[model samples]
Target: MSINRSVENMAKGGMSMEEFKAWVRENIDADEDGKITKDELADIIRRNGEWFAGWKARKWMRSADSNRNGVVDEIEIGNLAEFVQKHFGIKIIS
Candidate 1:
């Protein structure tokens, strides 16, 4: 399924943290790798808002990349719903 379809499904009832992380990877992982880079994250944030894309992406990476590998991996993604709520101002219950 496409990312749009997955997001639509999430809006209907929400999905698990793992599912949400997969959705994020599918949408943002331009290199098709298992990890997401800071640029990819910044691009997503830029698409969402006009201000502080760099700062927000760095902050997100710092918070989400638990292993400090300079990228966010599937295992490192925790409570993505909470991240969305804090950053995009959209509350997700999953």
Candidate 2:
């Protein structure tokens, strides 16, 4: 599902941040590698209905990838979540 749809679902279901993070891992981690790459992040942003998905993804990746390992690993997901909330208006109940 798209990120916007997911957010709507989350809002309707009252998901916590932890649950939303898990949802990202399960749904957005297309490679199933337990990490989110820039491409994957871009895809998610694109799915969120952003016309400038690539640019937004690059910005978010740069901000969230604290380790500079070219991927957002588990530790960096919090950063990703914050960015998503701030930029996409995704509200996590917790």
Candidate 3:
């Protein structure tokens, strides 16, 4: 495996949804539902997107926590975001 991918995978071993999503973004570009295909995965990694640039880009994608239970929305987006920010320093902007 490539160095970046190896590191990303290593980080993912203990990832939550937020962290997974962030890793996905830098390492993945998933669609609205957070599902990724093999082709898309290849395309994303090939582009050389780091696991996290730590940039506070402007965006406010709907929370993956769809249930509104005040906890990950019963999804992985928040968790993934947290991980990305914490490990890679990629800031999440609203």
Candidate 4:
């Protein structure tokens, strides 16, 4: 199931962009993969703001480790569109 980008990112809940980024990074960077890639971003978004409990705990841990650098950093994480095109095997909307 897909998750609401805003829902998972609701931690910011009226905070500033910096705070929002931090919250998103904290949750999105679950594997500590420095940047939040498409797959990594997807999983975090997939959590659907549910806290990602259950079997997904260990399964999606390394789900977004596209770089294999052992961490998903912001600099490494590309835009959502770019990531979706490359990792999701879908046609980019340009």
Whole-model Cα lDDT per candidate?
0.67, 0.79, 0.44, 0.47
Best by TM-score: 2
Q: Where is model 4 more than 4 Å wrong at Cα? A: 1-13, 49-94
Winning candidate number (lDDT): 2
Clashing residue pairs in candidate 4, if any? 32-71, 33-71, 33-72, 33-73, 34-71, 34-72, 34-73, 35-72, 35-73
Write candidate 1's Cα lDDT for 1-94 as tens digits.
1123336556555566667767787788888888888898788767655578788778778778878888877676663456665654443555
Q: Per-residue lDDT for 46 in model 4?
A: 53
lDDT of 2 by residue, 1-94 (tens): 2356766666664568788888988777998998998898788778777688888778889989998999998888889888777766666666
Cα deviation in Å at residue 11, candidate 4? 6.7
Give lDDT: candidate 4, residue 30.
66
TM-score of each: 0.69, 0.80, 0.32, 0.38
Model 4, global lDDT = 0.47
**Cα TM-score of candidate 4:** 0.38
Q: Where does model 3 exceed 4 Å of error?
A: 3-17, 25-27, 49-94
For candidate 3, lDDT tens digit of each residue in 16-94? 5455555566555545344533444445445555343222121112223344343232245565365445546545542
Error of model 2, residue 90, in angstroms: 2.4
In candidate 1, clashing pairs total: 0
1 versus 2: better TM-score goes to? 2
- Which residue segments of model 2 deviate by more than 4 Å? 1-3, 12-14
Alpha-carbon RMSD of each model: 4.8, 2.8, 12.1, 8.0
